[model samples]
Target: MTSLAEATGHALDLLLAGDAGLWQIIAISFKVSGSAILLATPPALLTAFVLAYLRFPGRRLLISLFSTLLSVPAVVVGLTLYLLLSNQGPLGDWRLLFTQSAMVMGQVVLAFPILVAMGHAALQSVDKRAWETARTLGASLLRAFFMVLREARFGLLAALLAAYGRIIAEVGASMMLGGNILDYTRNIPTAIALETSKGEFAQGIALGAILLLLAFTLNGILQHVQGKGVPST
Candidate 1:
């Protein structure tokens, strides 16, 4: 217990002293996950919208496939991407392995299915009349689509938060794809893993503190969004 308390104190000191390496790790985490989520969101949302609203052959199969992907292990994604980006791989000429971009790619694979599945559920729960009402008002198909999205905004936001949470917390994909290189591709999760392994508990605890704070902030925003979404009594 004394050792734990001392470690916690050291963690606080690290944060208070503004450790540059720690902050750099945090920044890399956000940069990679942010880029992955941003790049994946539009297409994921579009696919969700289609699955929720459109009728087509094998659509159910596609939805099932995406839903299955939601549970895939992070290391599996990293391995598959690693293979594709390795020197002998077909697309290896781009030389993206063991880089931040590779980490982003792995995260994109992880987040895309999550966004699609959650976004589909959200869009499906929304009233069908939203699209119809917009069309009744002579809104273009694009405008009607926007109307549906507006109605599903809260749920979509929830999906976004969930995706961010997953990617930010994931370690295997980032570690394998980014190689956990110092001052470059190192991120919070991988850094925590490395630091803890080296008996450097303070930095790991500090990074964990930041992650906890971020989780709290996201939950707060989710609650606020939910409150605003609810109809007044």
Candidate 2:
């Protein structure tokens, strides 16, 4: 108990003192995860819309694939991405491996299925009459689509928030593709892993605390957005 208390005190000191490395890791984490979510949102939204409204061949298969992917292990994603970005792989010439972009790419892939699935649910929950009413009022197909989207805005926002939560908390893909390089690709999860392994429990605890705070802040924002009826950007 004494050792635990001492460790807690040390962790608090590190956090209060504003360690530079910790801040760098936090920044990198936000940058990679934020960028991944942003880049993924458009396609996810479009795919969800199609899945919810359009009836075509293989739609069920596509939905099934995404559902399966939602349960996919993070390590599998990391290994798959690593192989694709390795020297002998198709994308090897790009030299993207071990970079922030690589980490973002992996996260984007990881988050895509969740975004698509949830977004589809949100869109499907909208009233069909809403779309018909807009169409009857002479709204173009695009305008009617937007109207349906507006009604489902809250659910869509939920999807975005969920995707953000997943990407930010994930460690495997980021570590594998980014190489967890200090001051570069290192993020909260990767930093926590590396620090704990090295017996730097104080820094690890501090990062873990920050990560928990981030999760809380995100959930708060999600609730606010849902209450405000704001359209996800």
Per lDDT, the best of the predicted structures is 1
What digit string (tens of lDDT, one per residue) describes model 1 on residues 106-206? Answer: 99999999999999999999888888889999999988988889889999999999999999999999999999999999999999999899888888899
Clashing residue pairs, backbone N/CA/C < 3 A, model 2: none
**Residue-wise C-alpha lDDT for candidate 2, range 115-200, written one tens digit per residue:** 99999999988877887899999999989988988899889888888899888889899889999999999999999999888777
TM-score per model over all chains: 0.96, 0.92
What local lDDT score does residue 176 receive in model 1, on the 0 to 100 scale?
90
Q: Indicate which candidate wins on TM-score.
A: 1
Off by over 4 Å in 1: 231-233
